[model samples]
Target: MTGHHLAVGAVLRRGKDILLISDPPDWALPGGSVEPGEPLLTKVTQETGFTSVLPERLLWVARYPAAGVEYEMLGFEVTGVGPHDGSGSWVPLPEAVDRLGRMWFAPIRDPAVAYLTGRARVATLWTWTDLNEAPVTHPHVAPA
Candidate 1:
């Protein structure tokens, strides 16, 4: 079993809806695990393919009741959109399940998503951050 976990997510707001994953067995806001020492910017871009990916601070933390996992998650707000190199289009929160298949591990819902989404419910996209050697808080990642 896994112990404490850490990750970064977006409190993404496109119009009124926030990005989320609805696929069952596990549902959540679109986010992923943060490997030690990785820059949040590169991770989100690789996971969500949102060329506009920028890392930010605060947002909030999350604690799951099921496995009792706690994570200090960073949240970014995507401000623009661009073509995905060879991947796919950015999916809306509602269509997450139909568009992308479910993730392998448990999907985490960051407190930031719900807070920003203004709903008690939110879903997430699955991904894992690469190893990080650089400290977090890049000039492009800090809250603006």
Candidate 2:
């Protein structure tokens, strides 16, 4: 019951498969904390044994259906996995979600994924719609 937001993460893999931290009935990504001066994405990769540079962070979803706390989760596309990592499995998006609470794999159906599909922030990575906005500040990378 400490201040926390429902964060989620994904380790995007080949064949469009993903590494999921699953449960049952609801799947979630690998993420936590929204502290100011922290590089959220790097922390996920470092802690989870994934690559330091995630492919992308696709969403910033906010959920505050509680009291005295605010949670802002940033969802990302993790790239590679290291050997001896605890879990490295291919989980389809749908199955990852359906198995939520039953297991703790990477999440495949975090609602934030749907919410950020058309966001300009993510589009910058895929479509490169706004290169002018490059060097635009980042939590880890300063605008240069």
Candidate 3:
């Protein structure tokens, strides 16, 4: 893990539906890399086309290594957005969880499910290996 970058993601929710983007065969959250002096909300809105965004809370932090780069990914629970521009799919929470589970990114799946299901009271940390086939290791759970 020689290279490092900071990224931010949003778990956009409208009622029970979660906003997901189809990047080829995988489903992903609507977010991108956070630049210096740029707000997380601004980055999320730019990626998702949601004009009004209210970041509810920081849900999770993931240390994922891929392609020889270590990524510090942050997931936030966001709300108060209007209709999207059809750049992504709005699926029900259950289906969203199922889709996320099948993808290689366990960081997005675990925290989203935990927070939405009322299981996660505080932000959790997840560490993932570089290999796509390898499973996540040492998942951190917040104390009750």
The candidate maximizing TM-score is 3
Q: Estimate, for each residue in 1-144, the C-alpha lDDT of model 1 and write its tens digit.
A: 356667765545566444554446554445577776866655556655567665433454343323444444545565435754533334465554433334443223323423444432223222223222222221222221
In lDDT terms, which candidate is top? 3
| Per-model TM-score on C-alpha atoms | 0.47, 0.51, 0.76
Clashing pairs in 3: none
- Report lDDT per candidate: 0.45, 0.44, 0.74
Candidate 3 — which residues are off by over 4 angstroms? 1-3, 114-119, 129-144
* Candidate 3: 10-residue stretch with minimal lDDT: 135-144
lDDT of 3: 0.74
**Candidate 1 Cα errors over 4 Å, as ranges:** 1-5, 21-24, 63-70, 85-113, 117-144
> What TM-score, to 2 decimals, does candidate 3 have?
0.76
